[model samples]
Target: MTLPDPGKSYAQKRDALEHYFDRTAADAWRALTSDEKVSKIRATVRAGRDDMRAAILATLGDDLSGAQLLDAGCGTGALAVAAAERGAAVTAIDVSPTMIEIARERTAMAVPAGATAGPGEIAFSAGDMSAAPDGPFTHVVAMDSLIHYELPDIIEALSAWAPRVTGSIVFTIAPGTPMLMAMHAVGGLFPRGDRAPAIAPVPPARLLKAIAATPALKDFTPGRTLRVSRGFYKSQLMELVKR
Candidate 1:
């Protein structure tokens, strides 16, 4: 797959994603913040995502206090809100307006009353990470979202944010192994398949090359590889530091 141009403005890319999510925006929101039964169903559908986020945070080490984080493509604000709970100031952005709205609502509901707050805050926005706002963040994350675009686009998007990071970037993508390719083929053949978008893993080498192409990025290291049931594909996580 070829990556989209990095030159496109964040707003433009966001508009495209918003258009796609418009059809199911309301349903997505409802599922995210639904009652116990509905939320459980949603969780089952997104089980892999929950696992991936947990793994990413684990790779980041235990000390997350007072860190500023940028969560790109923060669907329903899962990772963003979790980070805030851990005492990190988080700015979560997504291309889908509905997703952002749902995430904001969830964030509000999750915060405890009369709790001593730190520098942590969960802020949601409708923006694209491909061209995110400038930041000097402690950590930048894009989980299960970069696979939508090709390698070049992923590189450009992550690179733009990498330079502004004083700490590290933790990202996850579906690998393009034989199993993953076969799964994608099946999904294409049968749209009703349980697998969802960005779930089919891409090749780790491709991701590494993308990072290498960006002179501003280095220390590309592979993290854990986890098999997610939804996509039936093994997801690879990686961490990179700006050189």
Candidate 2:
């Protein structure tokens, strides 16, 4: 609920996401993040996401000792835990309280029962990621978070954090390919209760253009970018680092 005043469109998208993740989709989301057997499409999504997480973490370099990170929209805390295990203090935030609860359980199980010193500590919070506290963060990763928002909202979200981040801002967007755009259209035709939030496809070229035009983000320039396409999941990862 820690939402800074967002524009109407952003607020609407945020509220829908909160409701869907917190209530309608909690169990299904948990299953997706776990090792449980799932449909072929869901399995592909899981694989794509796994690969995306590794690629994103790799971009931050192998060792994260003494680093501070923000895992915005950190569903299930997989990436957050991995970063912490590498010795980074991580702040993991998600809109779903259910997701935060699962993240806590997973984190406890990750470190040994009575270790002298655990890997860098993780502080979990259930709130709007746009409201994440200002930090001189070494890194910030927002995997699969902004796909549902329009370009302007995406820009706003990035702008809000760019000033606070000292390292990189890495995030994923649904590629504006015909297949995905058609999928988005078909998804919207489903019963309102049965649909996930609509992912607004964004072309990589357009995103780069927007970044260049944004003044608050003038200090940042494109870094490593990757596209992970495994079955149904088609997300493009983009990284921004200070000039």
Candidate 3:
């Protein structure tokens, strides 16, 4: 897997990622809107985010009360709203402007009036994780947003943000198992008018090794690995905590 070129400006990277999502915007909207049109696998993949978010909150336990939380690469604010409902002051960031817009709408509807997180306390913005508001958060949650990202890039981002988090970092990622790879290869054989955004899977062992090598995570310990089944494929939900 290739790392994003260090020489490229953050704007350039953001533009490229945006372009990709823009191309697949219709697919995303359809998946979100019409369940009848979505395949079983697609539905499972989408549901995995909600499951991951709940698991992250559960891991946070009583510590979630009044905790500062960062929901990086937040898509549509579901997880952020959930965190806020659990009493976290959350900052949710996404790369796509369209996504940010939808996230804001969702947050408004889902977050109850007089919630623990006051008005604007659970803010959603459009930008990469690097541009997410500075934080000394008690917990950080990134759901399945990294599926399209490479392992090296993921490790770098996690390492860079690790110092800002005091409690735990929990996320779910697509594992590069032979079965999963084969499924991708088979899916590629079919033709479509608009191609779906690429979902790159990472080898679980390699990802763990890379995370361990990162200086910022040297003292963090891996917690339980939950198996999230996506019909034909599977993902892993992992928790890393510093104590």
Q: Considering every candidate listed, which one attains the maximal TM-score?
A: 2
Worst 10 residues of 2 by lDDT: 109-118
Q: What are the lDDT figures for the candidates, one per model?
A: 0.63, 0.81, 0.66
Encode model 2's per-residue lDDT on 134-170: one tens digit a residue: 7778888999999887789889999988988988999
lDDT of 3 by residue, 87-124 (tens): 77887877877776666665453333224344236866
TM-score of every model? 0.75, 0.89, 0.79
Give every collision pair in model 3: none
| Best-to-worst ranking by TM-score | 2, 3, 1
lDDT of 1 by residue, 150-225 (tens): 5656677776886678878888766655566555445332223323333334577766766676675764444444
Deviation of model 1 at 120, angstroms = 2.3
Q: Give the TM-score of candidate 1.
A: 0.75
Model 3: residues >4 Å from true position, as ranges? 1-14, 30-37, 109-120, 178-191
